[model samples]
Target: MENMPMPKTRKPNAQWDANATKIFNEICVEQVLANNKPQGCLNNKGYANLISQFNERTGRNYTRVQMKNRWDALKADFTTWKTLLLSASGLGIDPKTGTIAASDDWWEEKINVMPLCKKFRFAPLDNDEDVEIMFSGASYTNTNAVAPGAREGSAGNGNGNGNGNCNDKDNGSDDVQEVYPSPAEKQPVKRGAAYKSPKKGKKNFRDM
Candidate 1:
């Protein structure tokens, strides 16, 4: 029997450390909220500028799609936090006394208390559901196989030629060409391999 394919994992970008989160938080607060706007609200130009600034400062590559997804996740977290705060106020407490206030000060205090980096960090995905959440529209394919739209015989070895095969006509060498595996290839585990739990850690994706 064939073994089931193992899930692929990626590491978090170190450049998108605490500093990047701080910058993002400040941008939203100063540029968007200071003018009496909602949290996590940004126009196209605003988002573009934010991405540019983040990449420029951190020297990291972040696509626009990633920034948008990250913003959505942050906004969702903010909304959930507010909802929980509102719900807590009604439990065994006087409404007028305000046991748990959800005010601007409260919001700012929450933001100040924790860095956005920690708040938005993603735990490593261990199941299909987690992968779906992290990569909603992405399709996983075997990197060892040619891509769907790739021209036949066009997958080349980084040598600039479309032909992966070494030919005496192309280069005056009758030696057999050495083929290398694509970096994205995943080696299959043997059947009945023991399952091991992944160590507790965070992973970064375009969304995070």
Candidate 2:
């Protein structure tokens, strides 16, 4: 009989706690906003930086595969959460808990169709903005990539985006609307009592 080849042992997955997950999400959000994401995915250099930042912040020695796994998981979570958000648009989010304001029955019904959504119902749904930026195609795709000439500027910022200075300037607003006093607040211009000006060549003499 032919000898059977032995199966390779599987590597254990690195489980991230809440703090680590939060840190990872925050790093991903920052990178996405910095335009490190192209076509809804991080470029090679961007991914490296993301890994470095995530490991630094969490003090964990996670491999690239682990980070990528978490990234994929987050993307899936965002998709599920978004669908839930649209379906339950009328439901309010609790300010204190950050969870959706829905009855148990509603969640039960939704979870049957979206089993992945079960985690969100019980867990505090935080980082709404970060997840939107990191996972949403619409958000990341809108950002323009670094122009050929703008590479130096991006390199200086080290975020791999176009014109690093422009991002902050954009957030500050380009077209600042000047606020003028209301008509009621305007003061009448002060002028000398309606005295006619002297003729062009003649000057008015003061009373002796």
Candidate 3:
């Protein structure tokens, strides 16, 4: 009889402590808002910077690969939490309650209000407007791969998607909203607002 090859076992991911997870989420939100990038946007350079900052702030050493892996896991969990919350909210059920009426025990056990709220400071459940902005920006895609020609201020002219407006000038309308926390906070906080884009103006092709 031919010898059968043994099944390969994958190593389990390192568990991130509560503090590490909190700091990582804060860093992600801050970087996204400050750079006017996207949510969950962490490039290689950004990852290195985050590692340095994490070490400086917490005095803990975490490699880039480790941070990236942790981020991936956290993001997946966060996404699941958001989906469940949205579904529950749609049915007029408060997710903070003891049990989610539309969900199973697994979801009920996995969905914790404090962590979900803390992780997604700008979650839609807390603020409906934030969700609108998130959908409008649609920056959830890989932000590092932004096209060279897709510079800021050329909003409606890039790739026919009309979503590249990222200037600082404000439009004279109340539609734009600011979701980032105050500088004093230095961390993510729950608030309802959209990621403000540049004022709408005549498109300048040169800037593209």
Cα lDDT of model 3 by residue, 1-208, tens digit: 9999999874334346656656766665554433433222343444556778887887776555566555444444445444554444433332333223333343334446434533333222322232222222233223433334433222332222223222222222211122444446433222222222133531222211
Full-model lDDT for every candidate: 0.36, 0.56, 0.41
Model 1 C-alpha lDDT per residue in residues 145-177, reported as the tens digit of each score: 222332212322321212211121211222223
lDDT of 2 by residue, 48-157 (tens): 78889887877767766666666666666767776776676556664433556677678789989998777666443456556756655443423533233321112343
Considering every candidate listed, which one attains the maximal TM-score? 2
Every candidate's CA RMSD? 23.9, 23.6, 15.6
For model 3, where is the 10-residue window of minimal lDDT?
Answer: 168-177
Predicted structure 1: lDDT:
0.36
Model 2, CA-based lDDT: 0.56
Clashes of each: 0, 0, 0
Q: Alpha carbon lDDT of residue 21, candidate 3?
A: 58
Cα-based RMSD of candidate 1: 23.9
